[model samples]
Target: MATTSPSERLLKTICGSCLILAPAVLLVGGLLHPEETTNAARQFEIIVANLGRWELAHWLIAASMLLMIGAVVGLAHLLHEHRPTEGIIGGATTMVGVMALFAIASAEAAIVPQIGRSGDAQLFASIVTSGGFWVLLGPVLLLPLGLIIMSYGMYRSRVAQTWVAGTVALGSAAFAVSLPTGSPVAFAIGLVLMFVGLARVGWSVLAETDEQWHHPPQMGAQLAG
Candidate 1:
């Protein structure tokens, strides 16, 4: 096994840590989100009353999403090295899906929560029913889709063990299936599977110098020059 270069090691570490942390942050945010009551106004009031915590959760969620984007991009680079063609497809899918999810979350973080804080029942009611709410659900499935695709790519590329690949693909699919039903626990668990799968591949790359990553001129300059 070839020892991983310093630059490669840094990216793997980032990928391992961030992908692992992303789901945790998401679960915590879900737990922090206000539960709906029978009264619409009452719900808004509750969120407003706990506005500080609500905003904090959104901020954390936003941060986690940003971290995910970084991790995914890093992982893509690794995958491209493992299997140039298929790895690109897998990594690209994951990157796009995760990016979409992140974009939606970031948008909500910027505006949707502010509506709750404003204490406007009419505005809240109107906004919540608007396309904005549905848009949130739109990106939810993309994440799992990407994960499943990436897992398949990993398996095909011989990037990880069969069991690890199966776990990632199954878990990701389950996560997608569970989302519409509003299951945060399942999503979090699915993320754990992906983290483990990525870890297996990442560690292999880190420990084995069999795979070498060639950075472009600009990137090489940034990392080594």
Candidate 2:
């Protein structure tokens, strides 16, 4: 049997963990989120009332984005052999979207809390109305788009179960739409589905032997020959 390198083993562990943990963390964050309202002042009041939970939730969400970056790259690597084009494009696009969402979550966790602490509803409202906020938010749409593309690649490559790919695509779309539409029910459903899909992938990764994880079967065969 071919030996697995230490680095490969570590990489596999990290990616597998991220795939499982990212969605789970995001779910916790979503569940912890306080009530939101259309009114800026009312939203600020809600934040103030549940300050600790609010900050923790956004911070968790930001962390999940960072974790998801690793998960997406791992997925791309898995798909590269069978569907290189989709793997690369989907990974890059998803990375950009995840990073943008990370910024938004960070701002909410760090800056919004400060604004609420200052009791500046008008300032918060002004910031929201300003074009810059929406500009920052727009890239988030890329997340669902990338997920759908990636899921299609997974389906075509037969790397994952068809149901898994379908669930991820549907969940990502629902999650993205829920954000702008303020549909908490959809958000929760999306996260649950995503968790189910990703956890299966993660489990598969974790089940791989170090040698199997390090080299694709074809590559291993080539090396053996």
Q: Which residue pairs in model 1 clash with each other?
A: 2-208, 2-209
Clashes of 2: 0
Q: Name the top lDDT candidate.
A: 2
Residue 51, candidate 1: how far off, in angstroms?
Answer: 2.2
Alpha-carbon local distance difference test for all models: 0.62, 0.81
lDDT per residue (tens digit) for residues 136-159 in model 1? 666667767776776666566555
Query: What's model 1's lDDT at 8?
Result: 67
Q: What is the lDDT of candidate 1?
A: 0.62
Tens-place lDDT digits, model 2, residues 1-225: 767778877888888888899989989999998987777778878988888998999999999998998789777866788878888999888888898889999999999889888888899889877877668667887877787788888788776777878888888888888878889989999899888887777777777776656543332122121
TM-score, candidate 2, is 0.91
Error of 2 at 52 (Å): 0.9
The TM-scores of all predictions, comma-separated, are 0.72, 0.91
Q: Which residue pairs show backbone clashes in model 2? A: none
